[model samples]
Each structure stands twice: as C-alpha cells, then as structure tokens.
Target chain A: MNFSHIDLLSFKSSPSPQKPLTLAPWRKLLYIKQEYPDNYVDESFLENLQKNVNFQSFDYFALCRESTVITEHISSVLIFVAVFIQLYHDHLDPHLLVSLGSAFVFLGCIIWEWCLARPAPPMHKSFLKTAAVFFLTLLGLSPILRTLTQGISSDSIWAMSVCLFITNILFFDYSSDLTYSIQFPGSVALNAAVFACVLLASRLSTNLHAFGFMSFALEWFALFPIFRRYLKRIMPTGHLIQTLLLVAITFVLFWPISRAIAVLYMIAVFSLTFICPIWLIFIQRYKNEIHGPWDEARPKVHRFRSPQR
Target chain B: MPALNICLASDFFYPNTGGVEAHLYSLSQCLLRRGHKVIIITHAYGKRTGVRYLSDGLKVYYIPGLVIYNQATLPTVFGNFPIFRYIFIREQIQVIHGHGSLSPFCHEAILHARTMGLKACFTDHSLFGFADTGSIITNKMLKFTLSDIDHVICVSHTSKENTVLRAALNPLNVSAIPNAIVGSLLKPDPTAADPEWITIVVACRLVYRKGIDLLVAIIPRICHQYPRVKFIIGGDGPRRIDLEQMRESYVLQDRVELLGAVQAADIHKLLVRGNIFLNTSLTEAFCIGIVEAACCGLLVVTTKVGGVPEVLPEHIIKFAAPEEDDLVRAVSLAIETVHVRDQRPELDPFVLHETVKRMYSWMDVAVRTERVYYSIMKVEAPPLIERLRRYYGCGQWAGKLFCILAAIDFLLYLFLEWAFPRQNIEIAPRFDHKRYVEKAVWRH
Candidate 1:
C-alpha cells in the first residue's frame, strides 16, 4: 500500500462492534490490548495535529520595510567599492578622501550619540585620540601589508578580494537585535572585510595610500554597522533615508566609471529591496511549520534567593 | 506461526549503560522469550569486539567502527554496508530494528536494510524541536532514512507526533510503544520507620538540555521554603560544576548532597530513600527514570514538557511549568503533601508499586512491539517505484537528492551481492527455542 496517501484524519477504524468488542475507556495509552486492531488509528490519533498554529503571517509592507537593512548593507558595500575604485584610479586624492571620511564619521558619531539619547562627550579629543591610535597602528602595518601579497599576480589578488568582499556582505549580521554590544556576524565577517581591505590596499603604490584606505575601511566596515544599528533603532525614517542616500552616492560615484554597471547595480538594489519581499509574501502560503506537544520546551528560569536566607 | 530472525541495531548496548541500552537489552530478551530469534548489532566498545553472547543466550555482534561523541558510531554512509550485509546473511535476519534517533549507526543500518529489501523498523527515543539548525539537518536525514522504512515506533505519544513530523511518516505505521522498567528490581523499602525529613532525589545526566540550570536555580529556593527538605542529586556532566557552584554560593553543602554518577542498579535504592523524585528535564520522550522512581514509591514532581505528563497518572505526579519559580512551587507543594501524608500513614508503598507495575513493564512493551512487527510482516514490501514515489514527496531538491541516494544504495547492494555472495557466508547457529507460556494479565 502507498502509505504516503494515508490521511491520518480520515483513516478511522471499522466501528462495527463485532465479537463482543472490549470497549475500554479511552486513554492516551494503555498496555492492555483493546478490541481495536494494532493499526487502528482512532479519532483522537490526529486530534493534536496542529498545522501552522505558531506561524506568523508576514505583511508585504512590513516585510519590505525589513528588507531595508539588507539594502543598506549592500549600499554600504557598493559605496566602499566605488570609493576604492576611484582611489585606485587616482581620480580621488588619498588625503582628501581620508579627511572627508573622518569628517563624515565624526558627524555620524554625533548623530549616533543623539540617537542613543545621551549627552555628547567631548567629541574632538576622544575622536582624535582614537583616530591617532588607529592611524599609528595602520601606519606601522602599511609596509607589511603592502608586500603581504607582493609575489601574487594582480589578477589573483583582485579575484581573492572580490571573494572576500562577497563573503563579508553575505555573513553580515542583519538581525534586529541590537542589545548585544559586540554585534553579530562576529569576527569571521570582520576578518573577511579586513582581509579584503588589506588585499585592495596592497595594489596602491605608496604606504600612505594603503594606510589611508585601511583606516577608512576600518571606519566603514567595523564602526558603520554599529552606527546603522543605532540609527535603525532610534529613527526608522532616518534609517531609510540613510539607505537611499548611500545608494544615490554609490550610483553617482560609479556612474563615471561605467554607466551600464551603475544602472545594473541600482536595478539590483531596487529588486532586492522591493521584489524580494513580494516574493517572500507570495511564498508565505507554502509555510507549513508543524508544531505540537512533542517539541522540546524552552526552559524559563528566573533568579532565586540563596538557601541561607 | 513460524518465528522470524530479527536483528536489533543500535549504537548503545551492554558495555555502555543508558536508557536506550537497557531498553534494547530488555526488549530483545522479551522478544527472545516469546520464541523469536533476536541478535544485537552495536559498535565495538574499547576492547570488546566480534560476536559475544549475553546471559539467556542473546547474541550480540560488536562490529568494529570509529566511535565518536557519546559512543555513537561516526556516520559513514555505505561504510558498514558490507559487514552489515554479511551479518544479515549469517544471522538469516528477516527484520532489522534500529533504535535511537541520534545513532547514525541505526540510521545507516535502516538505509542498508531497505536497500537489501528487508523490513526496517525505527524506534525514536528522544524528542527534537524543528527550530534549531542541528535539528533541521537531523530531521532531514531522518526523513531520508524513514522515507522507505516499513514501520516506525516511538516511546511516547509525544514522541510519535515528533517522529511523524520529523520523518513525515504515516501515523498508522508509527506505533507509540513506551520504554518499560523491570518491575521486580524496583521493590520499595518498607523498613524506613521515620519520615521526618522529606528527601527529593534527582538522577539524570546533568546537561543543559536536562535543565540543570533550572535545577540549580530552584534548589536554594526549595530548600529555603521547607527546612526539612534535602536534595540528593545523581549523574554528572559538564553542568555539574554549575550545580556545585550554586550549592557553594548558596551555602547548601549540608542540605544538598551531590552523588556524582551512580550505577543504574543503585537508582531504585536512591529513589526509595527520597519521598519525592524531581525531574527538571527540558525535554524527554518517555522518561524511564521517572517510571522507575514511581515504581519505587516516590511521588514524582516533573516539568510538563515532552512526553512526561502522559507517562504517569495525574494523581501520583505533580506537574510544573519548565520554569524555576514554578518548579519551586511544585516541589514545595509536593513536600507539604508528602509531609502531611507521612503523618497520616495512609500512603501505601505497595499500592504505588502495584500501580507502576501495571502501567509499565518490559514484557508489555515487547508484546506491543511484537504486534507491530506482526502487522508490518503481514504487508508485503511495496514496489521500488512506489517507494521512490513516497521519497519524491520529501521536498523539491531533497526529493530528487533522496531518489539519487536511494538508487545509489540499491546499486551498492547489488555490487555487494556480486562481490560477496550470500550463500558463501556461514550462517550463525540459532539458540534453542523455548515453548511460549502465556502469563496471566494483571488488571487493576
């Protein structure tokens, strides 16, 4: 018999009370054999089969709203690529890019402080102190990094950087929980981005160019995600605006390099942000997560006083 | 009816002591008593290898394999097929019964059994959730393994539900047969004259999933609520340190006793010392430990999780939500009830023992299990195309993948048959058959 077609709800045992059917009181389980056959699926067999009971329905708009985080993350990666390409081509000066990036980072910190609803600290001193220490470390490491992959071919270096950058974007933590100070996606993602930055920086001629790029990469990859998380938490509208502004800036920067590529990137961004959510909603009808009394219970424990009390 | 040769496959057995191991041994013994030839096939432990016979002439084949975490053999698909085939041919096995979901050996055995066109039965002993990544992968594997199996058995109704969802098996094919205790071993101690202090016993592996954290959190509160209460914990794991730390920080050294890992034989003795048996497990399929404790006349107070609530009648058990405060409240109530009952002397240990004996026994489980076997044997093996059709409903890509896997397994079986002809292998001598005697059923 084809067992898959056996509908648990429909397969009732023959109710004919023949041969003095020992009708025992209905219990969930019993060792003593009842008159029913071994395969007799009673009415209560699938009574607890709860279908999609714990399933949370998704609203199209809310889902689209949530996809904004993915869009923002992709936009940031694209903007960083655009900036790196311009710097590599010598279309943008290293000193000017570093100064502008630092200024934006400072502005971002102030907005982040406001979002956190905290009185701003003496920003210039702490910011400069952190920047000084970061730049000093980068300066010391720039020479080593410049020659780290000196023997490798430029094509291999470029290919490896692309893969690492893709890894960075794929593993980025986009979960809404921002309570953790360390952030999700943890060290593996950060290491991938930093390795990609080091690889890209090695292509530059001078140590200072590599140093500037590395510092900016730190601010972009490490600090920017924390800032984005705070912005999303504090002002959702500002978060959307930030995503849009980043996308526009990336498009404008890349338009000069290749118009077709810039147009394709924008289309990809829009499709990922809008079309994906619609696709998710369309597929939500197929979501059939079956949960019942069988699943392991998550323990809920609160603090208890010491026995000495 | 002619008796059939059955091979019980699992990673757990005699050398290793666990609930599944005991269940397998007892079930095999009972099946043997009922005139069916049964042999166990498990991974070789430390030095024990090749075929060995346990007491009552039950044969065990300890196949040499790489033992990984928790003594489960590393899942090398098709690695054990040649030896398994040889064993099947040598034993002239008709049915292959696999136990324990976590046992990759059992899963592989079931897969190979179906490839060889033998009737395969699986017994799931634990509950699993669908949320976690590990569970997702395991569930998919279970679905693949069970796609073509003839029958599935679960230790509890909750477990039956879980296995059905995990493997997508027909509910009719999956029987809810619970693990049973040897009722004779758990006779209650009647010599303890004074019941002034209410001792609560907890004997389980102190793992996170076993709710050791909840146990640690509630111990202090429960002890403080009732001054006469004392805790005796058994079994040890990585979380035992946390429990010890809790005891130290709470200064409960005198009141709470930690008897690190006790033998299975000593559990009944421990339960008899305590008036209440506490189970703080986050999940359980069919808690044989709780049943054994109940058989020893200890009032059971357990979290209402998994198959625990259905294991015992409500009157003997006090249910608590799987939370620290709720467990404390439940244990406190049980302590009060036990204390009052002790004063009245109305609580009969013999009655509790009788109730537990009636509820669960190895012979009963074996009888039910044998019935499942009979039912499955009545039906002939479905055509390969029909089996493939069933597997094709698993998922889109997974269905195709499973079909490929099933086809490959079939080809491998053909290759093994060609390489080592079944007639070339020597058949193992069977045990002398005993005449079956019907024991009178004890009814309440």
Candidate 2:
C-alpha cells in the first residue's frame, strides 16, 4: 500500500466543480463530515480572537499621584532612622523627644475623630483607654527592654536591626484604598518592626532613653500609619502637605550628619517618585492578553443561591 | 500504506476511565483494524503493572510511577526517558502520540520522542484560563513540549484555538478531530417519551465546575414551575451532599432521583430513559457526554460554553447562558415545547440517530488521525540546530532555557543509545492482522 496513493485518493474525493460536491458551512467542528480536509483553516478561524480586550491604559500623571504612598512610607522610615541617630549620639534630649511625640499623637487623634462623619463616643473612649494602657505598660517594661540584648555584641545588634527593618519595609501593606483598614503593619510586618525597635532601644545607655525611644517607635510604626491613611482619605491636600513636610524634615536631619549622603538620598527618592511611573507607562504598550471563546466561562449567578449542604 | 508501529502515551488509560482514556482505546482499536500495530504506555495504577493485552490484541505497558492528584504522573522529566527509550526500541515505534495536556507522562513522552528523532503528536482535551497561576504554569510547560512537535490534534475548534494560543503553535499543524462515540450501542428507544411527564437526565461528576451549583439552584424552581417534571442525576462527587440536601429540603425525593456513580455501560440506558438531557457545565472542551446523549435521541439543553455550540445542529439543542434565571427560562421553554406547543421543536429520533451516526464515529477519528500521521511522516526530520531555532522563540529567557533543556535531552538520548544499544533489545511479536480481519468480518 503506497501512502502517496491514499493521499491522492482523498484529494480526488474532495469536492470539485465537475462533481458538484456539497460543502457544509464551517461550524468550527469536525463532528460533521465536510468537503474540506481535517486541517482546513477557514477565513473566520481567528475572527473572534481578541488581544488586550480588558487592558486599561495608564496615565503617567495619575500613576505618579498614586505612587505618593511609597514616597510617604520611605519618608516615615527615614525620619525614624534620623530620630534613632539623634538619640544614639545624645544630641536631642530624651524628655523633649517623648513630649513632642505625645503632643503629636494627641493632635492626630483629634484629627482622626474629625474625619469620621458619625463618631461614636464609645469608640473614642475605648481608643483613649487603649492608648493610656499601652503607654503605661511601655513605661514599666522599659528597664527590661533596655537590657533585652545586653549580652549580644554591638555589631550583631546593628545587623539584627537592619534585617528586621528591611523585612518591615518589604512587607508593608502599600494599598491606597482608604477603606482598607490599617492592620498595624499586620502579621510578620508588625512583628519585624517591633523587633527592630526593641533591638535599637537595647543599644540605649539608660532606661529613660529606651522608654522614650520605644514609645516614639510604637507611635511611628503603629499609630502614625492609621493616621496617614485616614488623613489621605479625608483631605488629599493635607496628605500632600504632610508628605512634603516629612521629606523636608528628613533632608534637614540628614544634613547635620552628612551633606553628600543626604543629597544622594534626595535625588534617589525624587527619581523613584517621578521616573518609575513613566517607565511603567512605557512598558504597558507591550502587554498582550488574549481572550476568546476558548477561555473558561465564569458563571454569573444573580442572587446568592447556596445549597443547604 | 504499510503498517506503521505507533505508541499512544498518556497518564490516563484503563484502570482509569475518562473521555481521554476511552478516546485512546477506541482510536487504537480502530487503528489496529486498519492493520497498524498500536501499543499504549501509561503509568501503573496500583496492581496493574507491566505488559498487558486487551481482548482486541492492543498491548498496554504500564510503567511504575508516582500517581498524583487525578491519576496524573508526577513530572520527573528525565526519569521516564530510559525506560521509554527501551520500549521504543523493542517495539520499533515510528510515531509517538500523546493525549491530554495535564498528563505529565504525555508531555514527557513527547519531549523525549523529539530528542530521539521520532515524529511526535499531541492531543489537547481540556480548556484552560489564562488568568490563574496553575494555568500559567501549565501553559508554559505546554509551550516547552509543543515547541518542536510535528503535529497537534484538539477535540474541538475551541480546543484547537486554545492549544494554539497556549503552545504558540502554527495553526496549520493543529487539527480539530472531535471525540466520537460507538454509535451502534446508543439506539434511541421509541417508547421512552411521555407526553405528560418530561424527564431531564444529567449524568456527570457532581462538581462545581460541572455546574452542580446551578443544578441545585434550578431544580426546586423547575419542579415548582412544572409539577410533572422529573430529574435523574446519575453521578456522585463532593457536591453530592449539596444535591442530596437540596433534594431533602425541597422534599423532592419522588420527583428527583439520584443514582450515585453509574457505570459507563449504563450511561446509554440512563440517557435513553429521558426526553431531554440538561447539561449546565460552566466550562467544557468537547463534552462527549452530550454527544452520547444526542445519540440516544434526547434533546440536549446545554449551557453555551466552550465548543458546545458547535457540537450539534441547532434544531436538537437549546442553548442557555450559564446563569440561574437564563437556565430556568431555557428549561421552562424546552418543557413548554415538549408539552404544549410541540410542533417546531419535535424531532424524529430516527433522523437524529442517522445524523449523529453520520457525523461522528471512532472509525472516522482513526482515519483522520492516520492522515495526520502520514503527513507528519512525509517531512524529513530537521537538524538539531533547526529544532533549537524553533524552540528559541518561546520567550526571552524561556527560549534559551528551553534550548538548553533540548540540548541536554539530546545528549541524554545519545548516552542512552550508547549504554543500551538498540540492536541488542529483543523485538516484541506483532499481532497477526489476518485473524483480526476474519474476526471483524464475523462480528459485522
């Protein structure tokens, strides 16, 4: 049996003008026999093919506006570091720093209260009570925290803090949705930041310094993020003002330490905030998402109809 | 054409029952009738191991391996190559055809066949989404396996389009060969229809993807709308509890019957008992069950999902959107057509049977598949460099990675050939085709 002969037979059996073979319309299936071959690709083969059907084109300016979340987070981390350096060098008095942090916490609470449309008295009372208890507990635990890493080497302490801080920065919830609750850096993120603060406080020489710094770190990591989130929701202009004020303060604090390092940091922060969104828009041109009838059908049930299992 | 030695490789086969397994078995049986020597290679299922022969003289070699979820072999890429190479040599196999995209054994066999310089073909039997993590990984693996494949076969046009996009293959290389049924076994029963009571039969795995949720939601409403309607659900899965609960809550034990896990042989008997077959599957590739239902002369009311719209003529099918209200409306309309104004929708079961028989048969699938084999065999095998060139266009980094893997696989093939020289392996005895021809003639 010759293979080429079978091929020729199949070809001859196909519909021709003289034979007047009836050709079925291509319904894109091989169940029904037709005049065409098995591999015949009709003109409408890819007629339903769609590319980037649901793609949303990004605007560079809007993207930049959205990226202020990252800028705010970076500035907050930098300010914490600047405060640590000032405390470590014994340049700023511990009492003054603690008083300043307490005043700001009070002011932020009032603003947070103002942001709510229907403020509940019990929630405000419970929040104040929780804050009072947290501060008192921190003051009592200062001596223990000050000596938490007394046996560890200074170099190891520094390395541990660096690792924890990096973990905190990496896992921070940066979603810009105002309704998204601030979960206190949530899970591993919060643990890592608290661990880093404890390590840094253990490096202080006295209990008062440890207590002041520990309280300030708690306010910065835990409380300030909630305030910033609500502040952004209630007043976008105030959020922008807050970001600018933080950036200027960070630059000034770093200036006293090293002018060159501060200048490079400012340049890096500005470029990241401005240029990254543009790069994202540039790469959006290459996104190719193909959808067709071949994809799975997502069933649309209008009402919540759960079976009584 | 001279009989060519062929091997059907997949993780799914006998000891396991599914659409793909049945397809492989039926196709191999038809190919055997055409005088081709065919053997199946699959991962062992429990006590079913080593070489075994079915009643039709079709040999299956079950290699021992780890079975993962859904009877798929764990994808140890290079682990199966040595044994595969040995079997290929002993059987003198010329073509390696693989079935099912999710079967790691099939993908591995295709990859190794390419390395050994043999013609390779793949059949995709499922549709996958592009948004999910599992699909993304599976599509990447499919791309690697199909990068240098000789030909690809899909069960439907939607499946073909899906495979083409998933593997980035040339459309010309892929053929849409639908799954077929043993049409002779599914004879329509003339006494099955009742004018007063309409029975809607659904025989599929009771899973969420099979639209058991929609079935659960619509059953009570359907029963409420038409008091005489009956439902016969003939499969069981994790969703059986939900269905049973629905049956109890609605107090519909008399109208709705649940036959848990019916056998494949009984499917026709169950389908023939109903006037309509309701399939509410959210996603399907070809849906052979609906074809079987149609063969039993039942009007199919199925959701308009992947490849279903192309399955049957419009006269016998009522398409429904995969929504509760739409399905309820469609089923109600179908019931009305069957009961009240039953003129335009009424179809003669004999005509439907003839149409279905002419449209699909395993013998047709085998003939079309043999054509694919011949077309692939006519082209000379390309050089290794040329094969690498084809694989190099997979992705930016994936291209180079695939090239390296292909090169390594080629080297491994050379090593295996050197270690277990093919000339030394004993050849398996081929089945006598004259006896099969005599038996076929006697049976017919």
Candidate 3:
C-alpha cells in the first residue's frame, strides 16, 4: 500500500481559506502578541473538523489495519511457549535446539558480512571485523552471566524476569530502519532481555541447560530482530505465513488445556486486532492536530559527513 | 484588587542557566517588586534543597527528588500531592503557575493544584514538532496535563500558537508573553573605539537544533566575500566537531573566534563587541539571547524562523530564510546597510522597554494568573456541562476519557479532603518575611 497518498490526502483536508495564511491575523507564528479574548474553538470549529472524520474509516478498516501488530505479538508468545513445551516433553533435546539456534545465528552473521563486503569499502571491513569480535566476546562471556545471579532468591528472580519482559515491551524500538543515531530504546530492551536470560539461566540444574538458555537468548535477542527486520524489508508476505504457522502450532500444543481457554484467547486477540482498527478509525473523526507557525521548525541537515573522518 | 500570593512551579529554576530558568527568576523578582508574594517550587538541585531565599525576598522550595535527564525530575505523579498541599496552605498561595513543558514536576503540580481547587496556569517555554515518536508521546502527556489548566502562557505568539495546537487547548485561554532580559545588564558600550569592522557574534548552544550547522556552513563563504567581517561563536555542544571542520575547511583561523562557552555575565560585553548579532537557530520559543543582542544595540541578522521575526521590528532586523545561502545574503545586506547608514544605529531603550512591556511583565502575568485562582474558588463546583465541553474538544475518545479523568480528579479531591479533613491539618506560618526594596508599581 502506498503511504505517500494517505499523507497527501490528510494534508489536503486542512481548513484552507481563500486568503494567504501568512497575512491572516491568526497566522500560526508564535512571536506576535495576538489577543484572542474569546474562546478559540466553537461549534463551527467542530463542524469544520468533522470534514476529515470519515477519512478515518477508509484509512483504518478492521481486519486489514491491526492484523500485522496482533500477528507479530501473538506469534512471538506462541514461539516461546512452543520452545518451553518441547523442552518439557523432551521431543527435542534442549542442547541440540540451543546448538541449532546458535549455528543459524552464526550463519546469519556470515551472510551479513558477505552482503556488506560487496558494497562497502575495504576500510569498513575493519569496522565489521571489530563488530564480529565484539559479538564473539559477548558469546564468550555468556557462561559467566549464567552463574552471576546465583545469590538472588527465586522470588526476586521471578519479579526481575517480569520487570525485564515489561521493559523489553516498553522500550522496544519498533523502527525497522534503525536509522536513529542513539537507538537507546532498542539497546535498553536488548540489555533487559540479556539480563533476564542470565538470571533465568542461573536457576538451571545442569551446565547444558544453562548453555541452552544462553544460546536461545542470543537467537531471540540478537539474531531474531535482525531476521524480522530483514523479512519486513524484503518479504513481508512471509511474515504473515510465519505468523499463521506459529498460531496453528500453539493451538496444537495447547490442545490438552480446556478448549474454552484456547478459544477465549483466540477470540480476544482476534477482536483486539479487528476491533482496535475500528476504534482507531472512530477516534480519528476527532484527530484535529493543530499545526501552526509556533511549533518548532524541524532542522533540515543539508551536509552529510562522508564516512571517512 | 489586592496583591495575591503566587507560587511558580517548574522542574527548572535558579542556578539552572537557560532562557526559561532565567525568565522564571527575573519574572519572580519583578512579581515580588509588585508587592505580590512569589514562591517557587522546584526539584532539588545540588545542595540547594529545602527553603532558600533569593534577592528581593523571593522564596524557593527545592523539594528533594531524583534529577532525571537535563535536570527534569523523575515524574512520580501523585507522590508530591501531600507536600504540595502543605506548601500551598502555609504560603497562602492564591495561584499555582507551572513552567516548562518537559518539567513533569510542574505538570504534576498543576494537576494537583487543580485537584486542590487552586487556579493553575502553565507556561510552555519550548517548541515541539508533531512528527517523531518522542514528540507524539510528549504531546499526549502535555494534553493530559493541559486538559484542565485554567490558563496557559507562552513566551511568544508563536509559542502560544504552538501550545494551543500541541495541547489541543483553546487559543483564547492561552496568552502570548515574550521573555525579557535585564536591559541594564546588556547596555551598549560607549567607551570602546574599535574600527568599524562588521563583527558578527553568534551566541547559542552549538547544538543541531540551534542551527549551528547553518552558521558553520555559511561563515566561510561570508568571510571570503567580506574580509572586514569577523565571527565570534560562543556556547559548546556535540556539534563542535562540525564547526571545527568548517573552520578548518574554510581555513578561517584568524577571521573566526570560537569561544567554546561564555559565561552569562560576559554575554553582554561579547555581544556589544560585535556589529551584527547572527542567530541561525531552526527553532526558538522566545530567543532571550537575540533580545539581549538587540538590547546591546547590535544590528540583528537572524533567520526568520520560530519567534525571531516577531521578537524584533522589521527596521531593526535583517531577516533570512533558514538556509546557508540566505543567511550569508542576509549578513551581506546587513553589513551593506550598516556601511551606508548616515546616523548612528538606534539603541533606543524605550523601544525594548515598550516591546517587553507590551508583551509581558511579571506582575501582569501574576495578576492574570491570580484571576484563574479566584475563578476556580468562587464557584462551589465546576458545572458538568462546562467540564464536558472542555473535555469533548480534546479528541473523540480522548474527549470522553478526559471528561472521565476530570470527574475522577474532582471526586478524588473531595474524598481526600473529607477523609483527612483540612480542619485537622494545621498550616505552618511563613518561613521568613524579610523586607526588600524595588517593588513593581501596580498600574491598576
């Protein structure tokens, strides 16, 4: 779907009076001392605002609009539960699953290196090597992390894990491009996830279980996000397929539980995904985001420094 | 009309150096001069905790709290309610005026003040964009805080417009009040007899938003054309490298002086040393520095962005588009205009005095703010219809949600007072009432 048109459509709906906006007494410029003795808004204002309300329905149709968000969240939760079920049933050895995930991650990194090596200059190769070494060091330190939280109580661990998960959700930088310089939000979430895994690993009875958890952590925290971003960028259709497959797998795994609970969860998630878009569309009827000259002017950076210092 | 006791609440206050912090201090002092008691409630900074007194008997209470990024205190929404109530009762504060949008402390204070049935006024000192995630979240939070504010104050007409749009508030409820600098502090130097070199002084934090990049990009081209022109850049930030690179790129070592950061006291002296005050900031709520430069009798060459154009009259300023080429052209025009001028540049103190007086005065702000207080108190309770009207305008779902929040807040206030009756709570006396001079003359 082309997003450019939607933006244009939204912009065109602005209250365009015949006179030039600049010369008007109510020019949005913040500097002048204009007296608005009476109320700025009225029934007429709301009536004017209503012109753009119906546009929301077309922009945010149920089933189509919110399905992407719901699918991703649901799939991630299902994948986690599936991994735990496989561990409990011993259908797949934890160590083997851990090793497979680690190998896949390493292979993904190699692919990334190969891809970068084509377009990037030789100088950038050194930076990529440094990044590789950094990841290697992190992998080397994983075992130490597994044992670091031995002294903490189980109750504390449970509370800490919950806090970490919430942090991951709250601070997750949803921007697919990762164009921001800081990326503090994504980094914080990754850090919290790493901390949670380390604390959880310490409770494991065997070194194998600890290593399995650490490897799984690397797959989930580091590589999965990269894969997700790549898929989102390239084959977004595959994401839908993956989401559906995960849902089917979760339903099959949780068949032993009362069918009602599974059905209830499905109904709730489906309603949320479908109903939210409608709600959002309804709400958009009143989304009169007032833009005036007083709002801060965004600085456009004309000069971009070459990668070379 | 009697002088009212007013409390100015903000996360940023004295000892903090910025346009907003300075404005708060000077305005509070001016309000004090009007015989109105001004008290400030801000988060604790350094060792400046508990009750402290500044010049002119202006009282400040730096309540202890964890200072977050850029000195904005951690926002524990309902935590400060009890202490705030105590302070309000003790000080006999008729008005609660909050400052700065980033200050969640002030927002919380305003909410609590409204909940306590006190008149609450808010002053937004910075501009924000509607785009970007940070701004979207900030705007939402601002709307939540501003939903029930009695009146809103902005430093400039631009700021007022921005605030009204950003918070979805009624424009009539908001007032455009420009910031003022001490005209005496920034007086033009009469003693120095330097050559008529077109010295351009750029004094601002060398940050991306300040348009330091624009200045850095244009300075070299400007220098090559006009050899008599010299540049003095002040303030330091992450963008120092860009400026340094530009300096080296242009090989303008002797022509440009980079005084990494200059003290506030030296700003006036430095400003007066230059013929042109160059501001290339992309965004400014109300530029105090440019006003100070104007006050110092410097010919202004500034980007006509944000509140810069509104700050100075067209005759006094040479305005430029916020582009490198335009700024250079503007500077050239200003230099040419100065060279061809027959009379000495008008450094009329009266112009500034009138401009500043017309826009805002601390006493005027205090009086305006005081009216909100009495309006809230005079009524037994806010009518549901009025509440619904205000809330309904916020947004569709948000309007209904806000109406619910307002109702909950109103009920919570009654429940709190009833549960812990005010009669049982003893009010503390004034900490200190030291007599001071320089009371502002009340015009009314």
Index of the highest-DockQ prediction? 1
TM-score of chain B of 2: 0.96
Query: Clashing residue pairs, candidate 2?
Result: none
Better of 1 and 3 by lDDT: 1
lDDT per model vs. reference:
0.82, 0.84, 0.69
What DockQ class does candidate 1 belong to? acceptable
Q: lDDT per residue, candidate 1, A134-226, as tens digits?
A: 778878989998889778889998899889988987888888445334545655678899999988888887887787788889988888887
Q: Where does candidate 3 stray beyond 4 Å?
A: A1-290, A300-309, B190-196, B343-435, B438-444
Calculate each model's fnat, 2 decimals: 0.51, 0.52, 0.33
DockQ of candidate model 1: 0.38
- The two-chain DockQ for each candidate, comma-separated, is 0.38, 0.33, 0.16
lDDT, candidate 2, B243-353, per-residue tens: 998899889999899999988788888988888899999889999988888888888899999889888888778899999899999898878766543454347676677
Taking the tens digit of each residue's C-alpha lDDT, what string does model 3 give over A213-270? 6667766766577555555555567766766666676677666544775676577667
State the lDDT of candidate 1 residue by residue for B317-342, as single tens digits.
89999988888889988888885765
Q: Each model's RMSD to truth, in Å?
A: 4.4, 4.0, 10.4
Model 2 chain B worst lDDT window (10 residues) = B337-346
Candidate 1 chain A weakest ten by summed lDDT? A5-14
Model 2 agreement with the true structure over A1-309: per-residue lDDT tens digits:
011212433422254766544666666655666667666667888788898999998888888777777788778887898898899999989999889999998886775566454432324457778988999999999999999888889899889988888888788877744333446445466688889889888888788999999999988987787677767776888888888898898899999988997898799778877999888988999998888887767676655655443
Which CAPRI tier for candidate 3? incorrect
